[model samples]
Target: MLNREFIFSNPEVLKWIDNKFIFVAGDDWYRRRAQDDASVWFKSIARKARRGKNGSTQQGCYAVTPKGELLRFINTSDPKKFTVTMLEALKLWDGVVQDKKVTIPEMKNFDYKVNVPPIDPSKDVLIKVQSRALTEKDGKLERWNSNGKAGGKPAVGHLWIKQAEWQSIVQNFKTMEVGETTPLTKRLIHRIAKFHLIDNTRGEGPAWESKDLKHAKVTLTRVKNGFAIRGMFLLTNQKKSLSHSTELSGEITINQSTARPVSWTMIAYGKHRGEGKYTRNARPGAQPLGFTFEFLPASKIRPIDLVPPQHMRWQRGYWEAEKH
Candidate 1:
């Protein structure tokens, strides 16, 4: 997360730092636990920035309290301003990013007249997404079944993409064999999110297991406006042959409607394996590992369609197709 920690000359951030605040610059914050001494949290959502890609060196400061309270969120502007605000309680400056040029995505209405699979957003149309890594690894998690055999392999890969779609998504996907630079299209991410939403409508799973919840410190709590089934748990997993195992502790939330999760969040924290395409720094891996399910009515969505990757590519190559 944070590659360097400086003894702040300014007393504002310093106080939090002294009180155990941590500063990080990446989405890694969402994956790992906040530092032990961190009373304040600062993270940068800088995922990646490249041409024809959805990634960008996030130019924002997402400052929050230790107890998970929003303090400041400044995107694509002078980040140092955040430090100034931290110094003053009443003083807060935000929403100072460069104005994004307005552009509209080509929208296409689906052929409803034909036998387009009738879908009901509500009810059983739930998006049951297990922890991408923890959910279905075919015992490749190196956790319970460290043998790394081909047992519980998922039908799809992370980002919930099917094999056919993945091939198309990676069509324009360029990368350097030797260098660290890699690129991903912006449309791809959005499509993946859309796919996740659609594919999940065809499944079932829990935000977490009762067995895991049994060990968690479950409680009834209020979030925003509604009641929630909140729980905290410290979990450990190891293979019998391994010398040491991994330990994780995190909080989970199951919003109103116990029988049907209205909106729930589950995050788990553990050691960092420093394994992945890009290991930015050395920090304990805090994974948002858990099952999350969400459902939405078609009426609530935008006026567009989930067309094939080829269609999008053709649109991009078409004369009127402007750069996003």
Candidate 2:
């Protein structure tokens, strides 16, 4: 979050980045496995970095040539330090390119399963999910910040609704009278409660198990030209040491002629307690955490933003979370 709000968000830094380099974002967790030639080549460059010690994470910025020669690498969250590193990298790049000509290598045996795109973009509905921790101040909730670092910026994620699921929702809307309410499908409700609701603001949180979902309920009420959605959920680990209790509310506007959702917005707000292996440091007790979900139509979605959901490493488990 710090890197995103400080470095990437800076217009001046972005200008240098856009003009000098071909930036690519990747998930090091999966890339480290070297499923194909591209990943293998990436590992060769990453192995030279400071964090490249065998079996440890090789996650950081790197300046490399087309033939995979590492020029500069640094792992720092500070914007000034990152900018300095980029400048140094550019100087080295200028020298290397002038001395030797490098050609891009043709990739063979690319791993599609490692970083899969959206499942059937024509039929799937994409929703952007943003999460952040909140602190109560002046009798109202505000973004949680610690000494101008961490927890201030929202963490982003994605959610996909399958064709059949969305079609069911639209059909339900058509059959209901104005103001009449209907519960969401068990599959959809459990999927959200078990996977999407968590404290990912700090880091990657563990997915809730089926047994951990103590309570999950959501409903949609037909309204004027749309539907009103409301729900509540409670999830706890097997040990009952960690838990999240949240209330959700949202509005979905539909295209009357096509019976498709034109806009969908939802918010989940409640108290969260405990932490996971990757996501540590609790706030002493239950603390306020919030999440917002916004639908992004096909036209609005960019190719870079089409990355799969976090839990999608195991595609079957993610798509059928309710069953598991």
Candidate 3:
């Protein structure tokens, strides 16, 4: 059971009497309230509440069709800004819903600031992954010590990945300091990324997590084309059977123009012990991996056909048959 009447209806909601929408709790979304359906045409917005800047959460408003295609959202939920905000939503709904082109408010600079690179999808991004022992020259392998060294040019741990349309892409990968080529399970790559593509496009939306983190501090700022949101939190608990826990810090570079992540990176450090396959040769403590995501335009993505260099071998992990 949760609070259902948390959202108050005002005169602004009256005009969209025919539209259908759900009013959910800002703190907990599972609680739902009824909507007013006094009109004939069902046009509404798919609104949800998210943690806003300054360590507060607010319910965002949206204008959408019956099928739940979003037209626009009201960014601010401040009482003082209600009148002006609703006025704007009204004009957008009237114009777009009515299918008559209407002039809308031009997006301007935000109230906060952060350092973010200006992104232009017009240019193709060259996505590359640097490796330590994956490249060799004349039967000699270039290796990176525990102190940190990037191997060679050909061992450029790059992948012929597919194009995607989401912010966060998390998938399990089996990697090690194997031969000259760190081959990945191509099928798993396709399976994981493709799964998110469908889930992201649907109304499921990004994981709206609010608990399980402590001493969390976040600084959010709107950048040129989107937002640069960085946050840090402490995790002191781990599952009983698990021998590792981590203090996590992550940054999400969101393309506000599209509400998709332009780049997302997470750094974990604290205590860790390898489990499963790594148990036989797993080291304890201080294994920090710089997991980064760089999204590229779908049109620029090419087919992946990885081939090992001369005298180098490829090691395919769990995604494929245990082929050496």
Candidate 4:
């Protein structure tokens, strides 16, 4: 299912000089893994990215770690920021030499939504508490005095939704690419070291055995509140088993296959912000954010989405010969 030209096309990206190893992986690897994940060679690279420090470069096509490792690369949502930082880094790294390495910078925007849990309904209390402060004269709050003390002034307090309407929320995903210049954070480095990339290819001959497998690229998506994220994935084989789920603490209310009729979920993580909501709290922290949708038949989802690719391109190929 993989072609040779596709595998070794990006020579610059495929070749690297590091203190330890040299490897090349990018579009070819991503495509191959995306296509037939059972291909033996696909598994090798898959293991490499998952088991090694190698990750994608800023451009999102492909990149190598300083230690000489292959990784899936991506760019941040803000293209300008990525370009500026990369250029600056290149200038710094080049020093006297005018020639600078063209690198893609990783981009990730963190947005946080504060959630207020719903209050229980049933409660009994005496109506002894009486105050003339908040009573409206003409359906409006009464004016207050300048003394700061309440003189028929309005009583301001927390507002609660007596009844809430269920609105369809859209789950947005932000992609970030990693590169040589990309600063390695302690948490990210740790994830790369402990992460496990798996290849999910449908097996032939015996239904249970893998026929021809290829590595697959799985990324993390940060979504807060109760909004559900959806995507159109290429299911090459109709028989291929597909399942969707989160890998973190939040709950998965609805996991649907078809897009025609979307699904909905109540009681989720964070708090819901109206339409086109945006926050600055979503980030990688104590709870690794991501969702694992194992192409394999039997799999479960965690709370967060997998980290999105920093900068990557869609290609139609695989990386097999390199391993063989």
Candidate 5:
């Protein structure tokens, strides 16, 4: 049985909590003396201890999950910082706030970063096999090395594809090389980019899926009118620590699918404008309201996905793929 009370209370003395490396010699004694809640905690600790080949003289313990997620364990001295770090870690693990494109300060200038959704190589192979047909000059049969080299101008239609499949399609596409035996056709590129977006949204909440569940991913931009229904993308991570940065140009579009007629608006982080109906609203959650991109005044009735380009770059420095 696990120690329910000891684990839930966040006991101060982790060692005495019965999950430390020090209890090897007297495992039974420590287990018996420990609170019932401590059992589960102990088993977790014991498992890690075994992995470390028994306890060490090191002062602090390793912060790990029941499944052995190794969070950097620091000495329990700075409770405040630890709490903050832990919350950040949890957010990262579950991809919390992954969709929100935040502005990160840089030494010289700030760069906007996006999270690249997971792609499967096998899907790439399939996309390569299923090439969209296209016409070449004079209606002759077109041949291309890759899908990216094939497609020509689109015919005013859209292809809604899953995230993994779309990535695979992109991966298989190759531009025609100069003087290559087989000249690449224009239709391939058209097929590859044919209004198809990779839907990265899968789980509950914004992080798991794209802002619009229908979209595989979205490109952020300043709103003149509203969002595009074809699709939109948001950042997401399997790990809670997946946070990316974006540059907030003069004003940007915020697509709220729930809002009927979808009231498109903007809120600046830290700016003040002369009082009027243009007053900004509070951040969707608890963030401070900055500036407002009110659509009511413009009467533009701009559709969603019709905004300034949001240069989103994924953070390559912080990628962690689970080992299969």
Candidate 6:
């Protein structure tokens, strides 16, 4: 998150990268093992990093030639350090020559399931979800600090609502009274509680199991603008070691004539405890963990926005979360 907000977001850094590199971003999970040209090329460069071929995580920046000769690799999030490494890599490239005789291999056995986006931007609703860890300091909530340093930046993920599900919601709204409230489907509620409302502020958090969602309920109250969303959820692992008890509140604006949602906003604020295997170094006890969901316009979608949800690797599990 810091890397995106600081390094990649810097105009000067972006100019250098845009002018000199064919920057490609990928998910490490599939790239490490997939049988494809892209994955093969990624492995060739990644194996030279400090993590090497055996480390559990080979996540870092790499500068390589078309022939897969690694020039430099660094894992620091510091923009200055990263920029220096980029400079050094460029200097090394100046002394090297490309091997035109080497031909790129055909991608025959690549994994297609891992490469597809979860939702169609033009047809489905995409909600941008951001989660962050917070702490109470002097009676006010602030970004959590780890060992006196700034806490990790907000984690981002997208929530997908199928067109069918969205249309069902609109139809339901049309039949409701002005102030009547209706509970959302268990499937939708569970999906949000299990996958979207996770504490991924520090790293990749695990999805909540069906049994972990002890209580989940979200209702929509018909209103003048659209509908009012209110709910609460409680999730806990079998051992009760990891938990998130949160209250949700938000509003949705709809196009009355078309019965389509024009704006959707939701916030989940609560105390979270424990951590996942990858997401460690959590506070000793419960702490504030908040997630905000906002409707993202299709026109505003960018290349980064096309990245699948963290848990979307298991497409069935993500879509039918309640059944799972």
Ten-residue segment with the worst summed lDDT in candidate 4? 198-207
Per-residue lDDT of candidate 1, residues 1-324 (tens digit) = 111122244455455546433654333222222232121122222221211123323344455443344554544323256555554422321331332223333424332222122223333222223323232355444322213332122212122223343333223222222222222233432332222211111122111112221233333333332233333333222321101112222221233232333443333222212221232221234422223433333345332212222112223222122223
lDDT of 4 by residue, 138-171 (tens): 5654432224321222211111111111112112
Q: What are the TM-scores, per candidate, against the unseen true structure?
A: 0.21, 0.88, 0.25, 0.16, 0.17, 0.84
Q: Which digits, one per residue and each the tens of the lDDT, describe model 6 over residues 69-116?
A: 888998776778888999999999888866723676675666667654
Evaluated at residue 171, the lDDT of candidate 5 is: 29
lDDT of 2 by residue, 67-92 (tens): 77788997776777889998998888
Candidate 3 per-residue lDDT, tens place, 268-293, comes to 23332232321232233323222223
Superposed Cα deviation of residue 314, candidate 3 (Å): 26
Over 4 Å off in model 6, which ranges? Answer: 1-18, 47-57, 65-71, 77-81, 92-110, 116-118, 147-152, 257-259
Instruction: Give candidate 4 misplaced runs (Cα > 4 Å).
Output: 1-74, 93-324
Which rank order by TM-score, best down to worst? 2, 6, 3, 1, 5, 4
| Higher-scoring candidate on TM-score, 2 or 4 | 2
| Total clashes in model 1, counting residue pairs 3 or more apart in sequence or in different chains | 12
Q: lDDT per prediction?
A: 0.29, 0.82, 0.30, 0.23, 0.27, 0.82
Clashing residue pairs, backbone N/CA/C < 3 A, model 2: none
Question: What is the full ranking by lDDT, best candidate first?
Answer: 6, 2, 3, 1, 5, 4
